[model samples]
Target: MPRSEYVASIRSRIGTDLLLLPGVTAVIRDEDRFLLARHQHSGLWSLIGGAVEPGEEPGEAVIREVFEETAANVRVRRIVGVYGGHPMMVTYPNGDQVGYVTTAYDCELLSPATPDLDELLEVGWFERDEIKTLPRRTWIDRVIDDVPRGSV
Candidate 1:
């Protein structure tokens, strides 16, 4: 099936009007740098995360998503912030919408592993100074800014 059709199928299963539901993103840090992923769909870099499955807690979702997307095990250290998925609409390359409510977490990597290249085109650690240069939507900047310094 096409990507849009697949997303629609998933949304239909949720039984909600919102296109996207609750999800988690990990702001993983190793020393002063943060782990980031270059998304396969948008080609824009973002934190590793995905939707929280039905019946699963937000913390559980982040751990599962980090391993699935990046192949790196992580532990949620703190809740960085909860964000409206409305702003970060899951727009496919063709402009299809997949709605979501993202929960951004400050997490710590529990193991060293390479990211799954098929889902994430690039994965690496970026310093705070470099984070400013990454090609990200404005919501990312707002989320990161909300994280208190030295909290991670």
Candidate 2:
């Protein structure tokens, strides 16, 4: 999916100034491995998810986002955390500044993915030990470290 229409509209008026937005992140796991997407815009591996649309719940948004970005069907098992403040602030490649109030969830992939190349450079599953070797954003590492090992 593209930068959400709601966010796009907001960006049009705000330019690159910081915008506080509600979003969701999916921490999908398959046995001992976790699914992560290499962001096309950021070039950093991160959890698969996107913004919550108007009237959409964070849990619902994560399921939709996971499917849109990776073509993977998933069920949100539980929320890992509700995070914001400095850790959520980000500057996109186009200089759009956003501070996300993100509700992240642990998810179970119901099937294999057919990744959307426009949104992600690549998508793969990595074991916990292997995650340390990848170039990942702080939030990704934080979510992985924070979530319980046998949740989803």
TM values, all candidates: 0.82, 0.92
Cα lDDT tens digits, model 2, 1-152, are 37778888887888999988898999888766888889888898888877899998888889999888878798878888887888788888888888888888988889888779998999898998798898887767777888777635
Model 2: residue 83 alpha-carbon error in angstroms: 1.7
What is the Å distance of residue 36 in model 1 from its true position? 0.5
What are the RMSDs of all candidates, in order?
Answer: 3.6, 1.5
Predicted candidate 1 versus true structure: per-residue lDDT over 1-152, tens digit per residue? 12334456766675434465677888887655778888777788888888777678999989988888867787788898988845777666654466667889988888985868777788888876688898965566767777666535
